[model samples]
Target: MKDLPADARPREKLLARGAAALSDTELLALLLRTGTAGRGVLQMAHELLAAPVDGGFGGISGLLHAGAEDLKRIKGMGGSSKRAQLVAVMELARRAIGQQLKEREVFSSPGAVKQYLQLHLAAKPHEVFAVLFLDAQNRLIAMEELFRGTLTQTSVYPREVVQRALQREAASVVLAHNHPSGTVQPSRADEALTQTLKAALALVDVRVLDHVIVAQGNALSMAEKGLI
Candidate 1:
């Protein structure tokens, strides 16, 4: 990596042309900082992405779910500092997305809701069922991950979901969960759970707005598909 001209350096390119000018690998190389004795930082970054860390591919989504120990498994990422840096970068990204959601009118923008859910639930290594509680006007009341399960399935209790909605005094809700397998297609089980929760929440006068299935970087809205 050091063999590259100064103008071609990741940091220099970022400073000269800004972050938008860098590719995903270039941004990752900046985080890696240094490489192993036999590898350059840029090469190491590429290897990290190429290596199968999760779902048979070491993509950015896999990295987002990787802990420090998981990151250390990468060839040039054995150092604790490098592991921490990578973990910190992912945390910053998650929080930045959260901050953006808080600033926007969530219900008015379905795309924003999808973006927030994707950032929050997508890339998780296991199943997570979450709810976005909204006021009568559709403003966000709260967001909660209510149930967690194995990689393939989660047992969502409609009673618990309804209780939380009542507690929040939410007038509406958005249901969401992630398929770690990187497919946003709603399963039969997903549809069943949504219907169950919808009926349960309706008893308390809470409307079910949508059920979104989040995958890698994509999301599918049940409402849009006429499934909800």
Candidate 2:
């Protein structure tokens, strides 16, 4: 490896120093672990950089769903190397998504909550329901995934929601769910569920801020529409 050119070497330097000391290509090479028949891991890293799909070629979250087979189709990626790269990318994305929410007012207004939820949940292919817990000042305390299911229903337990809020010591909360069909209109069930959950939470001194429905590129607020 010492005989290789500067760009062709990464792992050795990374081990000698630290990951933060390496460039983007070097980092990618580390993730890749090995190269194709003619290309080295570092070389493949450069290729990925030049053709980044979403955030960048090496954008962690962008490649979360990409398989090793897909990586193999690239010019300089092979079976083992591709698998390693894909796994590394997925782990990076998971860590990034699991990061703690910053200390900010998560939902001071209905519009703010709708905008924030739309960034991720709206584009998902399946249903995801989230509950955002806030304090008296409307600062975010916690955001929890309440349910995951199909278009029709998700097992929403009002008691569990109330319990979680009390555990977090939140003074207010907002409910959010997505519709994969790209329509932001609230269904009858959505309305009914929001009402039921709101009534339940009120007993515990936690105010329901709004119930937001997110779809492709659009979001609707129940409070804004006089529903909540």
* Number of the predicted model whose TM-score against the real structure is largest: 1
Root-mean-square deviation per candidate: 2.8, 7.5
Error of 1 at 101 (Å): 1.9
Task: Give the alpha carbon lDDT tens digit for every residue of 117-139 in model 2.
Answer: 76546656689989988888777
- Write down the TM-score of every candidate: 0.86, 0.57
Highest lDDT: which candidate? 1
* Model 1 TM: 0.86
Which pairs in model 1 have colliding backbones? none
